[model samples]
Target: MTHTPVDQADPPTPHRDLHSEQGALRGEHPGRAENPVIKVADLAWLEFEKPDLDRAETFARDFGFAIAARTEEALWLRGTFAGPPCMVIRRGRASRFIGPAFRAAERTDLVRLAAATGHAVRDIDVPGGAKSVSLLDPSGLPVRVVHCGEQLPALPEQEPLLLNFGTDHRRTNTTQRPPREPSRIQRLGHVVLETRSFLRTLDWYLDTLGLIVSDFLFLDGQRRRGPTMAFIRCDQGSLPVDHHTLALHLGPGTGYVHSAYQVTDLDSIAAGGEYLAERGYQRSWGIGRHIQGSQLFDYWRDPDRFMLEHFADGDLFSCDLEPGWAPMSASGLAQWGPPVTRDFLGANPSPAKLREVITALRDDNELDPARLLGLMKAMSS
Candidate 1:
């Protein structure tokens, strides 16, 4: 038998038509406004109301937050980075997320915002002295834009672990061991929320706070209907900022989903996960890289069942890049990780959730039967 000559040419490579930021903007919303009221500098802090302050303080410490100030009525939690506290938990009869506060780039921005919105600028009664203009979003969530005259000084930084790589060993003879402690949080990265009026809420952020969308996700068969999810970032001109400072998705209910805080690296995420696990805290979903921001993330639940995340190595983008669009599905959440948890997806049925679904369907809002069915399908997918 004559032996056939071995094929010398390489196999044909599959072509992937990757989506470009500019190309994705075709016939879609520009994810920005022509003239915004005021461009926010960054997220200042989140506010919450909890019945138990001591318990909240304990979890805050375990979640790697430094107590900036604590009183009988409130607790202010800060990260290692300088700025305002990451969050404030106030004493209340019920436990719930109040809302998010954004930092104004200039004090005059607050005056402009107040004039445009007809809300008066008032002094914020927090540890840091600041003036704020408050307004309610379309979904009835409280939103504040604040300008602080003084910021908390930067804390001592937590150095990243030295590692050894193949042919580029940086450490010799040194044992690799990250301590089993809470991951030191650097700063608040982003907050995710679910709203029934997604389009209106998204537009409000873009027009009011001058936020720009970094990415948009629509249901599998509903691209014409518009995006159901958006990852928004601050418009810092040419300065690169976190890929998403705020993310919103359409759902039956309107409320907080989760918030992420940046840590040092992967070792911080893993070792810190171990620390939380040993303390009997519940891990919701994590040890994976996200597709949108490309952050290595780990999520956990606090005593009040509020979700918080420890994330690192997130992508940064400037204002020049337009928003990229993609189809939303369970599998699209992360580039590589374990299956998304049912808890994180809110798949577990509860009485409150059932009531919210019924009310959203009956009322006049963006969510309808078709959109609800699409959301269900996306979750299952």
Candidate 2:
């Protein structure tokens, strides 16, 4: 399908982000897209190297994960849902992100990917037994796709509380305290990353994992430069999946940006945030509805400063759905929230960060000076 830019003659009033109307604009990516040999279904778990496993495990529990396995060297964490471990923390001298693992759509896809890429397929000995093929993504991050894991049984779920509205009353009497407990995350929802080569990295993912674009965002006034970021989802055919299982943004560093997990509801998210706060965990940004996925969210900083999100009620799309295109601006991030934080925007300056921005400005393939300037202007606006 062909895609054209949305006309800017009469823009909508500044009430919310342009995702709803803009999400209707969908089509094929600009260039040739081959069908990948393997289709990854869901984000499995994230790997992290932390100096203190105890501290990391503590934060994970407060953020609503139950301990799946804990050894002297590593820890496996999961939510109430039946799945493999949602997070793994390994003891290391310094804290750093390891990367995320995905569950392959079919078990044979793992073998297919291994045969095609010549990467060795290894048998996993962890909690949910499986076979996996690991490959380095274009962003130079390790990506593992696993298959044939024993599905863990779902634990008890927190039932959604009945809310009373002015006109529509569902509940008869009970007021809600929401348990003052950890919001039981249902599953690992999505992961976001920042990479150097935007198009190259994006194409690599599409060609490797059979992922499709759910939405694309570009710097304002630079449509010709293509998109600077894309919220990508797996092609699950008639089955609806999250708006984005993974998203990539153009940036200097190739590292983990954040990972989101689905909680029960807004009450879970809010009360969970309160629990984290009382425990002295840092709230990054949230308690807002995002423009892209439309998930009600709250973010927090883990013990190692990794970004983790608690989200609920995200948009889902069938594989037949096309992608949305929009401008990437700070204001375009959320429908309702406090102003976008500098840290969330990754605007914090370091000598290395300054150099990365400078290097990006110098690399025409990465981003032209005009487009970079336009992005800056958009952020400021």
Candidate 3:
């Protein structure tokens, strides 16, 4: 007797409100590359060109970075972590963000990356001697992949204050007093950038440096088109790393948005924010827990108007987890915090921003009329 064959294909999985488990099923781009040139270890440092080195150093100190090295032409800022400096600010005619540098896992990775990108590996002229391969992203931002010969030794850091939780008391007699000082940044957490060619730039980093997306945010009504913002992290195999080492979002202009540093805890963020406010520095946003990374954050503006964040208790993910997809909205920014600020959103109208919008609309890049409208809707939503 002949038996009838039955189809055993599983039904399609439905997308959840918080995350989409099946990217391929939804016709979305996979968050990683099959064969990348190199897998970078972490973000080494961010470079900036500032006109006033003295003013920059003052802000750096106030923002909780220890001066790793200072010279007549440049200043190197570091955290308490034993690694490369968190930032390098060079004296220049104007104050602007130069770009970010990623640390390669091995010297051979740098060689492989250089060979694949056709860029020669050159020596980095910073505090620690290093070899780097420099390249420009699709949005014209300079990116460096460096393999450093020496690592900066860990410095003394402020300890987290003991606290009493629900039914669990750590401190019995001590008063709950955190010092009114800088939050004492532990390490650079992540950097966020705005780029006109978001997809191209995103693909470049994933393909070249082997970064993977931790989360993806798509504009309202533009899910089919693709994600407009991506929180990307380094691929460290089974080791859990920061939810985002770098984040990129599509915008009319290409520039730095903000950078985050890890602080001890909520008390540190609050006390540090108070210290900054007392010093006449502007608070952009925060003292709230973010939804994506689950980090308690406080954003402040430096003297030069660059935004930096003091964050703590961020999520970490291993390489096995798939990227989560969510809709982009202002309300979705944080789990608990004050309403998102206009300054943090770049909503304050400016002549330079107006000019950028006009130029981007007229250009041949990715920012189009519909895309811009979707972005605007996303911001307002």
Candidate 4:
């Protein structure tokens, strides 16, 4: 979405009780890698493993992805617009998120990445066949960089409804009524993940992908606790990009929390949610704008119970912007909406997952017990 230029000069900045400078996370660390082979351009797609390809396809199509291609063992789903598959579902016994893939800014970046990471550039085995090199993050999550892929041409988009305002009437006669259709998702806006090693994983992403933090959330009233979550955007020079292409949260286990897709507008999100509800799908949370990225969002559960969001009118950031810091809590999740759900907060942490988190804390020093207690206090507040 495009908007008229507004006064950006000395914009009022949001306060972070505990704030770090924009590049604070990029400072030298003894064990961190020295340099990235190349920076990525944008997020591409997410990989998943599911036992039932048919069920995944049904939910994906209803969720707004067009079937890019289908094989007996795999499924490739994309948004209405043209691009490489935005999602890949592979047949497997267990259902889980595999990882996320990114698009490289330059084709040569792939060669440098493969060489630097000691992984050979290999052919992508899904829709829009492309060459890619894969790397693992600090938490051992697979991240891929692709040199090239087919761009599916744009489909007919849903035009925004001309709405009349209290003071200004844009529509003179016609009553506004949106269709009961899956709000056409324009593109994948961002992928949010939960990781045990929040700081290490956050630093790894910042250092390697050249991603810049847009916002940092920490324990309320505990500025000394450090950042526990991040909303990060791609570094695209002076060009404005989505406020966040990726988000990370500190949680009991490491895996996908949810992925957000862009719709046309508020109508798209609401009408789309209604369509899904009419189809008997569960609404996870949303129909509200978030404070961090400022996206009007609506979340739903897919066939396999993975969360997918339909969002619109999100904020975009220029390279000149600095990171904003805020307190993290369930109540802080949105500016206005129904109370945040337990599932969204990763509440009721299983004993096994709790043990995994304890192990990660014992082995890696990201936060101390005081900070952890502060984090718990913030969450339960």
Candidate 5:
């Protein structure tokens, strides 16, 4: 896979002193060992739209993200978190791409992660009070890390179909207070990937990035779902984190696996799902429970078709643990759902269809036609 080398932007001004020093995690600087007040806080992903920047921006706002800022090249979206930007939409003639970002407890940890992983880490200076380290994952999507932000915002329930007093006022259970919304991201959780070299990628993340395997799926020659799938956690805890922050599958080019966002509880998962549906967004998967992370899961497809998941009540660890190697099989992927569906993996968009759409957008002068068209056409053609 080839890409135009990004113009080497100036590195962000280092802020080694400002980070909260608490029970700083393992990879942090030796001097910052006592910094315990760390939060796994926030995550950022990509959404690429071919023809309309306005449409993409509108969808993001309607979906509960706050529009932090925009430029000719991209639009930065923020959730309730106090971080710079949790999501970004780069003007392009393509769909969504999930790029996962891992947080560093301190600047020293960033140094360690960059050195050990061989990922070129650069600081990103955003306008006003935003700062971050922008880098690329193995899959080539932009990923970044910055300070944590506020919690997810509270959205009102969609108006019921009938707004009259005569509407069905069924028996009310007044004892229960309305459920609380999901908490702000403590830090970015994990990202799953589908790659041709699953083992190699998995090993790279573990060896270079300091991620520990909580569990794994041992597969046979045919790639049929086996008995167990592997689970890995960051090597900084005793209680296993929502298992497997990053996962990979044997398949095609480095495309997204799935980006998992954390919420506070099961009620928030259900409430948020309902809230999204009422707001007229498309719900892709879930509203079901999962076997591995042990959370209530709900998935929605954003405008660019990236699968964004809302998970609540997940398993956590006391400390970073080792990998749990298990048999890889079909049945083990889910604890409960209708069945594993192909659409979830994004088998819908074929190469030809994507090319056609890109072509149409370029010809119509939609989006960043001049700058992005060349890249889109090359990939598509």
Candidate 6:
């Protein structure tokens, strides 16, 4: 089941040809090439601490994820459509980095490589007996894998409250004026992570995860846009597999850069951002557009200071073919928006504020300020 990287001398296989037999959904766009491997089935789960559970839950709901279930130790959230839980918050000691859930090819290659690489497969005892295999990628991000067929239904328009007044009813629809309704989570788009070793991590993902770099963000010493990041797509599905499922940023510790959730339209992005600001969630950057994926984006901080994004209309490549790399510059992140800001990348929090942020990530009893204060001082210096 373990797949060694095809020797570079052997040449890249025709990924589109491999997928021709799979019945994967091929977009109508001409630029996209057929991908034979991964299509994002759904976002499985994400782990966070429990103290910030309420804030996290509220943010997710407003951002369009529906609450599936909650316990003293964890929370399970899903999209509006029926599917396995997509987000999971576990009671944990570390607020740094957790892992990502991925749908794999029907073949056993990924699963075998995961075990060979020392990752473990375990059943998440949430509600549904969702099975997964967890292992670290070359860059150290925890990657979980499972075969496909775990598809969730799409959202249906059945809410009477969302109905027009008096068009189909004799009564006035007061629910419209009651409160803002959340847009539904349509699909998982991509995750961005910070790592000091960009190329090394990129190589690891390509060798192990069967991801191909569609495009990259390379830069100079500063944030000039070069291909420092890898936008990897699954190779087993039909053409133009879901644009990049993951992106890697050059930084320390496998911490979050951001996680993108796809929504129905641009109006949802504007409405969602307004809702977050009214609730006092710190707006990081955006309510703008990006140069690469071209999603209308808005970024914000969770109670733990993790970044979550609401995006619409990302540019989809027709194929997984390498489109070449660009130099990394701060200006490259957005084609047109307020210039890239520090807070948007989460580098501006004072050490004390960051400590409070992490403290909020813990359960009711596990917080310790003395230890956190020391860690903060070290990071600040």
TM-scores vs. true structure, each candidate: 0.94, 0.91, 0.95, 0.88, 0.62, 0.70
Please tell me which model should have the higher TM-score, number 1 or number 5. Answer: 1
lDDT of 3 by residue, 1-381 (tens): 111113222234455334445533234667888888889999999999999999999888888999999999999999998999999999999999999999999999988998898999999887879999999998999999999999999999889888789999888867877789988988998999999888888998998899999888877766666778999999999999999999999998897999999988888889989988999999999789898888999999998899999999999999998988777888889888999998999988999989999999998877899999988887788
lDDT of 2 at 197: 76
Cα lDDT of model 5 by residue, 105-217, tens digit: 55565555555446655645343432345555443455554433333343333221222246666535544343333323322355666553444444445444455544444
Cα displacement (angstroms), candidate 3, residue 318, comes to 0.4
lDDT of 2 at 378: 73
Query: What would the per-residue lDDT of candidate 4 be over residues 1-381, giving only the tens digit for each residue?
Result: 111123222223445333334423332222122365576789998999999998888788788777778999999887766676688899999999999999889888888877777889999786657899888997789998886566877778878999878989989868888998888878888999987777778877876777887887766555444567888888887899998899987765687989999888898888888889999998888778788887888989887878999988888887677776666776676888888776666665688867866876676645557666776777676
Write model 2 residue lDDT over 1-381, tens digit each, in one string. Answer: 223445433244442244433343223254225677778888888888988888887888889998989999999988899878898889998999888899987888888999999998899867868899989987789999988568878989978988888989887767766788899988999999988777888888888888888888877666655678889887888999999999998776677999999999999999899999999988889889998989998888887778999999999988776666677888888889888887777777789888988886676557666766876777776
Model 5: per-residue Cα lDDT at residue 164: 24
Off by over 4 Å in 4: 1-36, 349-368
lDDT of each: 0.88, 0.81, 0.88, 0.77, 0.49, 0.58
User: In candidate 3, which residue pairs get closer than 3 Å at backbone N, Cα or C atoms, i.e. clash?
Assistant: none
Task: Output the better candidate (1/2) by lDDT.
Answer: 1
Q: Tens digit of lDDT per residue, candidate 1, span 1-381?
A: 111113322222231111246435235677888899999989999999999999999998888989999998999999999888899999999999999999999999999999999999999877869899999988999999999878899998768989878999899988977888989988998999999999889999998999999888877667667889999999999999999999999999898999999999999899989999998999999889988889999999999999999999999999899887777889988989999999999898999989999999998889999999999999999
Q: Rank the candidates by lDDT, best first.
A: 1, 3, 2, 4, 6, 5
Off by over 4 Å in 2: 1-17, 20-32, 359-365
Which regions of candidate 1 fall more than 4 Å away from where they truly are? 1-19, 23-25
Distance (Å) between predicted and true CA of 62, model 5?
4.1
Mind sharing the TM-score for model 6?
0.70
